[model samples]
Target: MDGVNAATTDPLARIAELPGVDEAVAEARTVVDRLLGHRVLRRRSADVSLESALRGAHASAVLDGAEAPLEQVRSGEADDPRVKGALRVSGELGQLVETWPKAPRQALARLHTLAAADGAGADRLGRPRSAAEQAEDPAGLGAPPAPIEVEVRLEALGALLERRSSAPAPVVSAVVHGELMALRPFGWGDGVVARAAERLVLIERGLDPKSLAAPELGHLQRREEYTAGLRAYLTGTPEGVRTWVLHCCAAIADGARDSLATCEALKRG
Candidate 1:
């Protein structure tokens, strides 16, 4: 609701105001603005977006331990449940974008349902992990928060999602991404849902409303850096959290580069 540089009580604003964030935000916006200005994107936004979603699905899947060559993903040859789950969430994100600010909990539940229905059991889909259900996770999310803690965090997160934050879209998106991953608010497919949520913020906040960027592709290309950023955020240090925010901004810029490449490929083909 407020400008990126606006002062607000929202904790996310502090992370956004960090030293490197302004430059990262500027570069990411500049790159995406250039991509959006391209004649090809102007005329064929839908087609290019479809292709971007395909790559984004692949990248999201890769982050969730479902690595596959882009060609394989394009051909529907990558059939792991994790990849399928990631694709499901990616496809559904556009539908949820408009409603996310109004009803984050419902939107998040739908995301969980889409991502974890196949592997997390139908009964567990769209719900938080139960006390009895909390066990060693198969998805390698590491130690998960307790059910009580998850519930508390969800309430806070829900409140935070009610409207736009003073933070820049990229910064807000990164916090959404990091918080979900760290909280693992749902029992399964937290990573998939986290990423889906980040994309929603980008669109809803007007950072990339056409949703042409392949952000997950950026994460896929630099998984090590991405993981380090999340780890830094988890450290609870201002410097660490700021590093993560900056990393996300950089990733979005890289995603814009991929969007430009996609435009060129589509025009050539």
Candidate 2:
């Protein structure tokens, strides 16, 4: 089928040209090992459905600031309702990862549905937008940007995902992040969608999404530097985007390691 031809000159290719992708992948592998090891330690009968609910709830909390400091969602704020929401989201995401091989399209659709629901104020976090207001917008959190010319970008992303031969995670993530951030489809949920979308990709790749070590969280951690990285991408050249991808890759590698450690500890206990 004639589709958007993903150019080797795309940002994913540019990321490969960077100095340390091999090292990043190697590090990512260690994190993956820990994740698998942790999973092995879980009770064989562990309720997959229940886990999914927990993960989804946690994801919601993080996106909604029902839980602040994404890292605290599991520990410090365990009792917080937002944390519970984030947990449910995360768990749901994990199950989706395990069961669904082709999840990107589904994930995107789900995110859009969530944003639309919110925009219509049907959700606790959503606000209302009139048909005219929704039609004229360019970028927001609850609905697609007005005029919606950017659906092409999403098409390009799906094409990239389909054509990837190997090393799909970083490539998929770089393209998805670039497009979503650029599109900013929903008024308030852009960041959440971007982050959640990355998590979805990682899970589909047979990696642990929770182990993502969340570059966005890291970005939040180093707000000034992270914002500068984002600004460089948004205002500078493609180099800025390349730099952000590298940073994100590094964050994922780091988060995987942390999750592995936590999983291992839990297993031992």
Top TM-score prediction, candidate number: 1
Model 2 ranges off by over 4 Å: 1-11, 38-88, 94-106, 114-120, 123-146, 165-167, 209-216
Clashes of 1: 0
Evaluated at residue 256, the lDDT of candidate 1 is 85
- Candidate 1, which segments miss by more than 4 Å at Cα? 1-8, 134-141
| CA lDDT of every candidate | 0.83, 0.51
Taking the tens digit of each residue's C-alpha lDDT, what string does model 1 give over 1-269? 55533555777777777788889899989998998888897679998888888888788877877767889888888877777888888788889887899999899999989988777888888988888875334334468778899889888988977855677899889988988888887766888888888988998889898888978888878888888888888887989889888888888888889989988988897
**TM value for model 2:** 0.66
